[model samples]
Structure formats: structure tokens, C-alpha cells
Target: MKNHFKIYISFLILFGLTSCSKLLEEVPKSQVNKDQFYQNEAQCIAGLNGCYDNLTDIFTHNLFKINEGSSDLAFWALDDADASFAISPANPGVGDIIWTAAYHGVMVCNATIVGINKSPVAEGRKKSLVAEAVTLRALYYYVLTSMFGDVPFYTKEVANFDDLEEITKLGRMPASDTRNYLIKDLAEYAPALPQIKTSLIVGNRVSASLAYILIAKMAMWEKKYDVALPALQKIMGIYGSLQSYKLVDILFRNKNIEESILEVQFAWSATGIRKTTLVAAITTPPRTANTSIYDGVEILELGDKANPSTSITPSDHLIDIFNKYPNDIREKIVMARDYNDKWFNRPSRDNFEGKPWMGPKFWAIQMDNKLDGNNQKVFRYADALLMAAECYNEIGNEAEALRYINMTKIRANIPILEVYPGKQSFFEELMDERGRELMGEYGRKWDLVRWGIFYDSINNTIATENEKIKANLRPYHEFYPIPDEEVFRSKGVLTNDAYKQ
Candidate 1:
């Protein structure tokens, strides 16, 4: 009975592997029994922390990165992108991280739920644990549905490794089936969940408000407009206000933002603690020695945390998108110019020094590391308003569409969005607004893909990249190659076209 959190997670992964493989007839080699664990409340909380730690894995980042890379919101590199070693991505459209991360999150959820079900904790605490588990499960399932199209749904504890093998044998579950599972569980648990009272940095378990937002999002994805509207209304009551303009620090902090409906919980409280600063380090200006700036490489005291190899730079298109939207709040979202770049004509001309690109959203880690405090916002109020406007526009309510779109502009103190009397092509304007507002946030890619802008933009990017370098383009490149290991491992059962490595 070591009672260490690390040991708990080790066993958790084993339980998942054994269950997926069907090789464990009894107990998987990877884990200990419930008798050996969950002896007390502290242990249970530690186990929950272990579950939260699962997101720190590479898989999660990969799955989530698709929201940025595959969409028109970002391009691989600019005409002058600094990463000299940027290679053409296989499944150049989607990354391989999703394949592993989604499954990993699902596995963690399975183990945690199993632990909660068997734990001796009070029924009230058990319910809280269940609520957290269900929300997280729904999130991972949401990612899987968005990426792979369909995935199996498992709610019970896989007693051992062998149970894992049994489920992997079944191929993809239909998208409708998986999404419905999310809605069912979220609906049951959300009402009992409380609102997150603290800031974002601390991993607040599933709050009622967060659950409502997530449920609303899932409903919207399924096109259940009536169901979605009510959930959104619930969230509006809790966190409807936009993040204030002055609390720029709020955006940079790891704590709960006034705008954040939900965020993945991550922490780096101990040594070897991993944080989400990969994008920051990659995009920060390369620090030459003796420079005052803490570029990603310079900041990492151990080995340079900067994966200068797979860097994320602001594309020229992204910069142009920002410029097109005059005086929008998104400009404050990411800072690119020297203190001042425009209006170089006045007496204070050239007063502020601007770099080719630098944005606080990506680079804020320079000041503090929890890279922890800064959450990658999964659901924010801005998205809600945008979606409402898009919906209104679709219904030919130009007046109503402008009403929602103007909300964002109003907050930014920019010229309010205008709608023509016979306004058409609202979708086009929505896409345009998303690029400027959500650039580098990782949601743009899906927005572009869903809107059918991927093929044209991807081809344009490939042609542009290949013209300068040398790489063959293929239609299949749109999806990332299924990892050969996953293909071979899942071969006996449940293999499908997406896994055609």
C-alpha cells in the first residue's frame, strides 16, 4: 500500500490496457485492486489528481491542436516563417496526437469512474467524483467524435485488462450514438454539479455551469437547437458577461476566467511538471544569447523546452486577417506590433518597437509558468455570441444576426457589425470574424473544416510550400496516417477505414 499518486496512475493505465486487450483474465499486470486503493478520502483525491494528470500526455495536445492546424485560421508557416526544418505533416490535415490522446483520456475516465464506483467515500463525494468523470468523459468523447467520426462508448469499469480487449474488438460507434451518450450523462449529472467559485488555475471539477456549456456545445454539434438553447441559457445566467477589458491578466492567468465556461485541468506543482507552453516557446522570437527577452529556448533551464523543430508561427494570412478587422478586440488578444506600428506619420512616429509577431495569448508564459494558470479556453462567451449570430443569419434574420455580432464589437469598442437589408452570405462573414478572433486558439481549424474551406486552403498551402521546397501532395494527406502500432494492435477487432494506415 504505497499510497503514492504515481503508483495509482501506473495501475490505472494498466487497468485500461488490460481491459482493452482481453489478455487479462483476472487482474491486469498494470494495476492494484480497489482493496489496496481508495482506503481514505485523501487517497481518493489523489486518484482524482492522477486522472487530471492524464491530459499532460502528448496525445491530448495532438488531438486539440487540430483546431488550429487543419483550419484556415492558421497556416503551417508564413512566406518568411522562421522554422527552417518544418516538414510536411502526414495526414497533413489532422495530427496523429488525436489517435492516442482521445483513447488515453477515455481510458483514464474508465479507471477513475471505476475507482469512484468502488470507493468507500461518502455518497455525496462519490456523486461529485462521478460528475467530474462524466464531464471529462464527454469532453474526450467529443474530441473523438470530431476527429475520428465515431468511437465506442464505455461507461462501466473494465475490471481488468481483458475487458479492454473485448471493447477494442468493436469498431467505431456511430457519431449519433456517442454524442447521445454524452448528452445523457451530462444531463443526469450537471444539475447536481456546483459552479466553479475559484479561478481557472486550480482544476475545478465539473461545475453545473461548465456542464451546461459543454452540454450546450454537444447539442449544437448534434444540431439539436432546442436542447442546446436551454443549456446555453443556463450558462448565460452563470457566466454570461464577457471577460472585462482591463483584466488582461485574467486571460493570462491559469485560474477561472470570467469568460471561461470550461477548461482542461493541468498543474505543475512538482518537479518534472509539464506545462502547456509548447506553442509559446515555438512562436517566441528566437533568443540570441545575452538578450533581455526570455524566448522559449532561453526560458527552459533544463533543455530548451522550445521544440524549434515543430514551431508554431503567425502566418501572414492570420496577420492580414487581424488587420482587416479594424480596431477589433482581437487585436488586444494577441500583440504583434512594436508598442506601435500603425500611424507612423505623427510626431510620435515609430515610438513603439514592434516585432514581426508576438502575441500575449501565446507568449504570456514568459512572465509566469503554470503555463498552468492560463487555460486553453474550451468554451468562451465569444463563441456563444458568434454561434447565435450565425444561427440568426442562417434564418435570414439580418437584424437579429447583427444584434449578436454587434455584441463582440461592442465589447471591443469597435465599429458595430452592420447587416444589409437583404444581407446574404452570413456564413462568409462568420468565418471571417472567427479567423481574427480565434487565431492560434485552435478552434479555427474545425470552424474552417466544417465550413468546407479546408480543401481549397490546404491545397493552396501545399502548392505554396511545394513550390518553394519539394514534396508530393496526395488527397489522403488530409487525414493523418493511422499509427502503425494502433493499426496492428486493434487488428483482431474494430478496425475501420480511418485506421487504414
Candidate 2:
């Protein structure tokens, strides 16, 4: 299914039916034109495929910088803007990349929704397809508000070049309002979406399970646990027993395993047509194609497709957390100071400044050059369980919280969190448990922000290596500033007041 979707996406791009990145700044009108397209079911499917295009790009380097790099789990290996927490509105690092990608995604999704609605497809199919576009648009807004706080929110499509004027004039809306709107939108679409277990379908497309998870996630960001808890339990009920899920070497090693809820699909093709990315290259240690030996150890090569850009690496705090639990099974899969029973002493900052390489969870064993085809796991059942535990703890259901948290711990073969003196203590431990379980994945920074501990957590970070982050991090640095170019382009309609100089 992933390969099938990738091929369809490639075809859409070739036909100019897919939206490009410039849609963020310019009109979303493609060369094929929406008027001529979406006349049938196949065309509507192609339009939906375009919406998934940017999702593949979202988890790449800069967003990784915003999501995990700025957080305690990892940091930019160099003195990059985000690593030093000196990302001004002027400089385009994390903010520009994520902002552009997310807005482009939103625009494409809006176009898809509008096109699908008017298409000649059958009623039921049109509803389901539009439901997907709505969910995907919600996802883009989710990224926007999560990273930028409030952004210019609009659901209407840019029907023509003239609409660009109205689009630019739009001002930032409250993140909470955007989130609440999306929560309701997803609810309306939930019934139209299929109830198939995402794992059974390998999470190739949006299902009710994915929609619920997104709803829960966005609701939690607003601290609306009353809205979030039921959505999470909906997933728990859908997926069924924790016994069916386990912590294994399945993350990137085996894409779209049974534990997966949604994965951004990627496929490697000898013809270079398959949708692939350099995520594995960015995450893995820098190495050459073949015969890459270092310090008497054969540094396992991540193939010759992409240059291993060691942009992001694990922080000392994350390393210590894994070390704190030597008996834990996840350490071998998550990170390693050594590989193949030998120290990965690569003499470059790309390889964690010769510290540790991200473990098998990210390594693309069959990568062709820099084109690692591993599907980036966006949402997994394990994450759903952890989120449920957080929601339960927030609602004062300690017993249920412990039950959910223990599911992962029990799978990891670590000690179960059997007891806690109070809700805060349990919540704190659950935070660490989430860290240990989902170390290199995205949303760690968002976790700190939503928990209202972003400032304290980074300031209290004991890692001497990240002192620069602590020094430069201000209270207002929680959400990145809207890019100066974007603010300027909006003709003062948009402002990053928190970053006004």
C-alpha cells in the first residue's frame, strides 16, 4: 500500500497535480489546474496524495531541530541557531523550514478538500476522501500552532491567484481556537472515516484511529483533558489489549509494524521514482558507502545515497537516562556509544562528536546511497498508551495511569511503575518513562511546553554540553517566532511580538 501510494504521488507530481512548496507563499494553483482535475475518483485520490507529500518532509532536519533538537533528548551537533537557542526571526533555520512546510501542507489539504467536495466521485467515497483532507489539514494546523503558537488560520481554498491577497491579509489566530476548531472538525469527520485497525492496514492512510489520536493530541496541548481522555480511550478500545503490542526492534528496522498507527510512507526505487528521504542519513553516524573503517572498527555504512549529515545528535541527559536503566531493553534499540560490539569512534561532529550513534531504531540497513526508504513512524500505539496514561493521571485516575504506563514498561522488561506518593510524582515519572520509550522521535519539546515545564527542564538540564541552550533560552522561546520574511510579507498584519527587537 505504501509503495502504491508513493507511485501515485510520483505520478501526481509529474502531471503537475501535486502542490509544491511555493504554495506557502504563492497561489496553490498547479499547472494542471484544479478545474480540469478532480473530475473523477482517481483524480481526487491523487489530490489527497499531494496532501501526504509534505508530511514526508515535515520530519526531516529542521523540524527535527524544533521537535527534538531544541528539547533535552537531542541537540544540533554544531552551533546551529536552534542548538544555541539564538534563532532570531530574521535567521531561517527551524522556523522557516517548519513554517513553510506546514503552511504548504495546509494549502494543499485545503485544495484537496475543496476539489474532492465538488468531484464527481460517489457520495460515500467523496465524504471519506474529504474527511482525509480535513484530518490532514488539521494535522498541518496542529504543526503550526504547536510550533508557532498562533498563526493565520483559514480553511478556505485559494481558488485563484486573486485570493492570495486575502490569504496574506489574514492575521494570526489563537492556538487554542485553532485547536478547538480542529477538534470539532475531526469529530464531524470521524464517523465518515473507516474504523479499520491502522496496524492491520500498515497505516498507509488516515483511519478513525489516526483521527482520534490527532484529536487527543491537539486537545491535550490545550490542556482540555476532558476532551482528550475519551479520544485516547477510543483508540485504546479500537486497538485492544496491550498484549498485542510490544517494544521491539521494529521502529525503522521494520516499517509499519503492528504497533504503528500512522507512518509517513517512503519507498526506495532503483528508478529513483519512489518517495524517499535523508532522515536516516541525518540521524545516523557519518560514513562512506563501503569499507568505512574507523579506529579498528568497521563503522557500519548507511549506504551511498545521501551524505550522512550528522545534524542532530543525542544529548548527555538522554544518554544518562538510558544508562540509568542498564537492565532496560530499549537502550540497545534506541542509542549506542558503540555499534557491532565496537566503539563508533568516527572523527566528525556528524557522528555525535564521536559520542554515540542513534541505534537500530533509525539505521537504514538497506539504504541506497542517501535515499533511506525507512518510513518515519509518526504515531504508534505505544504513544497512544503513554498519552492515555498522561490523560488519566491528569484526570486523577492514578490506578488507570499506572496500568497504561506499565504496559510499555512491562514490554521494555523494565520495572513497572507500581506506586507514587502523589499525582505530580507519578506524572514526573511518566514523563521520564515517555522519554525512555520515545527518545529520538518527535514531540518531546511540545511535551515540555504543554506540561509548562519547558523553561525549567532545559534550565535544570545537568548536561554541561548543553549549557549554551540553558544560557540563551528565554521564557518567550517556548514557541518559535514567525519568520521575519513571513511577518514582513503580511504587511504588518502578522507579528512576533514576543521576539520584537
The model with the greatest TM-score is 2
lDDT of 1 by residue, 382-494 (tens): 76677767656655667877887777667666676664434455666667676655555446645544445555765554345433212333333333444444545567344
TM-score of each: 0.77, 0.87
lDDT of 2 by residue, 153-192 (tens): 9888755544656787889999999999999999999878
How many backbone clashes does every candidate have? 28, 5
Quantify all predictions' global Cα lDDT against the true fold. Answer: 0.54, 0.75
Backbone clash pairs for candidate 2 read 304-369, 305-369, 305-370, 306-369, 306-370
RMSD of each: 5.8, 5.1
Q: Stretches of candidate 2 above 4 Å error?
A: 1-32, 286-290, 294-296, 299-307, 345-355, 366-370
